[model samples]
Target: MTYALHQGDALRVLASLPDASVDAVITDPPYNSGGRTAKERTSKTARAKYTSADAQHELADFPGENKDQHAYGYWLSLLLSEAYRVTREGGALLVFTDWRQSATTGDALQAGGWLWRGILPWHKPQARPQKGRFTQNCEFIYWGSKGAIDGDRNPVYLPGLYSASQPSGKSRVHITQKPVGVMRELTKICIPGGTILDFCAGSGSTGVAALLEGRNFVGIEATAHYAAIAEQRLRETQDGLAREAETRTT
Candidate 1:
């Protein structure tokens, strides 16, 4: 299976794909800051149009006493709704987010008619414990299916938590980048040989994981720089796979 990366807005790119085409979706989208990630780390390598400053300023200027960034709910509503339309009858949507937006996302999904399955806690092993509060090393991933029930479909149990490590080595990747191991685990639970879509795309971890597991992937990134990096990464994976296949044959 081929993994291709596209440089464009995720919401727009996703809309162009055929309906009910993808079997699964694994993504880490913007908390809507468009600039820095949740940790306020600069996505210096990302090619997105919006920046953390833009999102923050927009929220700050929002006409209300409440300065809450319900941005994901508003943006994801359109994306998730489209995701529902593009997913197969029993396909899945795996959405990643920090604690700040988990409940809001849950409510949005429910209101959008998505059948909530379970939540996965992504535990970052290398994360430093927070002071004055419990260690904030975990992120929430909501797994939902197109159907109301998975009675007849294959049973894919969602784990309460998944342990992974943060990126420590040198890499021209975005901040808050997902780990390959985490993506692999998520992919294994989805239908095999299925087409997967990742809107946030990041450094192409989801695509790499999908390719390594013999699945097809299509990733969309808002920034051209990151998209180019992802495309190159996919090509490298393909070449590596080809070499491995040839070695086995020889």
Candidate 2:
């Protein structure tokens, strides 16, 4: 498998790509949850209920520009437009978003010409708790197709509810990083041996998962720091895979 990591803005990098260049898009973009309510809650809390870490340190400290709901929707629409342009017909896009923005995300994808498929819930068993409310234990993956989705012949036959914990141990690179197990399962639903594009590459979890599943990858990250981390992680994953292959042959 081959992969390229671009250290630049996701929109600009995606715009430069050729049409129909990727078979799938699996990305975990920023949730834009840095509003006043969220900020107050985080400030009042000391540690996250799920883990012992400080609440502020649970996720990445990157800048999220979409503090306003309207701005967030507009930004998402622009990004999805590029994703739709680069993705091949029948290709799938599985994007992760928080509950607050899930509806807007779905609307944006529809406006961008993607056929709205359905939502896949990622159940976090170790989710942080809210005392007066339900545990914020689930995130939503908005699934859409470039064109039509044939139910009977879908490549990925997995259930809508995916129960997986966050990345741990050696897999934990980025604060908002997803587990490779979850990514690998999602990657299998893509066109076999086709290219996968992740605009918000973060720590390159998607790229690593794509390559390990025998698919090519193109990942674009805005931050140089995260991009460097992503590159290192991808290199490590590649090396490990190569060693495993050699061992099998020997």
* Candidate topping TM-score: 2
**Can you write out model 1's per-residue Cα lDDT over 1-250, one digit (the tens) per residue?**
7876777877788889888888887888764332335433232322232223332222111111122356557767778888777878878888887776778778766665578988899988766676787886788898888885454554666467889886544542555568887888898656778889897886788999899988899898876666776887888988999999999999
Scored against the true structure, residue 114 in model 1 reaches a CA lDDT of 79
Cα shift from native, residue 245, model 1 (Å): 0.9
Error of model 1, residue 247, in angstroms: 0.7
**RMSD (Å) per prediction:** 6.6, 3.4
Instruction: Rate residue 106 of model 1 by lDDT.
Output: 82
Q: Which ten residues in a row have the lowest lDDT in candidate 2?
A: 41-50
Q: Write the per-residue lDDT of candidate 2 for residues 1-250, one digit (tens) a residue.
A: 8899999988889989999999999998877653357554333321121234443344444545324567778888999999999998889999998887877899888888899889989998987688899897888899889888665554466777888899765656676788888898889877768899999998898999999999899999988878999999889888999999999999
Could you tell me how far off, in angstroms, the CA of residue 28 lies in candidate 2 after the best superposition?
0.9
Candidate 2 Cα outliers beyond 4 Å, as residue runs: 34-60, 150-154
Candidate models: Cα lDDT each = 0.72, 0.81
The pairs that clash in candidate 1 are: 35-51, 35-52, 47-223
